[model samples]
Target: MTAGEDISVRRKKLRYRAWHRGTKEMDLILGPYADAHTEALDEAGLDRLEALVNEEDPPLLKWVMGQEEPPENIDRGFLAEVIADHSARLAR
Candidate 1:
């Protein structure tokens, strides 16, 4: 996002990116998650999510699938929330 971009625009762009990752698995995982939660995110939360979506597929897939931990620079707390949300949906 550019400096001073509108939050709603940023949200829309993030949603698009989340839903359109190069792989089907990532698209499925992140598309619904973004749909459910992106509107509620504050700027900092969006920043965390942007960082996550910017990650390459392999490591991100591992992290989201609980097969590996994200690096220390990643926001574990926010990721936990995303994981929990995804888990809850799968349970339903």
Candidate 2:
């Protein structure tokens, strides 16, 4: 596949995984966020998102919901953007 096609395929796979996370709560959170933003993400953004999604749901959900902070090693700025975006969507 061409490089563009490969990236498109990877984005689609990520979106699918986001929408199908085992828990309904995670599915709702990540699914819409992925649908709205994954296409615009650069490689580094995608890598961060992939790492976020790979994390266990309990801690991930806690972090996203603002109930707890993510580890310092995580890309907190990007995750903050995600949370802000999600919050904005909810406000509309």
Candidate 3:
């Protein structure tokens, strides 16, 4: 490829890498913010958190957990709710 083409390809690769790193699947599955903030996590932690998230609206659950966003996703109310609920539950 020509020099310009090479640069474009590298830029595309870098963008993809950054996006993937920010939204890695494990971050979603493991509950990134919740995991970091929560304490005393044990065998029940994952199950409990997953259950709470499922109780939330599914699309909100996806967005908060980085799974998927709704077609017109924008507001962050769901994320805020998740963080608040998780923090409160894990505090005890």
lDDT of 3 by residue, 1-92 (tens): 99666545544443333233333542343354444433433434433444434333545446555677545434355345555655565676
Query: TM-score for model 2?
Result: 0.93
Off by over 4 Å in 1: 1-5
**What's the lDDT for residue 80 in model 1?**
85
lDDT of each: 0.89, 0.88, 0.45
**Alpha-carbon RMSD of each model:** 2.6, 1.0, 14.6
Order of quality (TM-score): 2, 1, 3
Give per-residue CA lDDT, model 1, range 6-89, as digits (tens): 898999999999999999988888888899999999999899899889988889889988899899998898778878888898
| Candidate rank order under lDDT | 1, 2, 3
Give the 10-residue window scoring lowest on summed lDDT in candidate 1.
1-10
- In terms of TM-score, how similar is model 3 to the real structure? 0.25
Candidate that scores best on TM-score? 2
Q: 18-84, model 2: which lDDT tens digit per residue?
A: 9988999888888899999999988888898898888888898899988998999888987888788
For model 2, give the 10-residue run with minimal summed lDDT.
77-86
Off by over 4 Å in 2: none
TM-score, per-candidate, Cα-based? 0.89, 0.93, 0.25
Following a full C-alpha superposition, what root-mean-square deviation does model 1 have from the true structure? 2.6
Between 1 and 3, whose lDDT is larger? Answer: 1
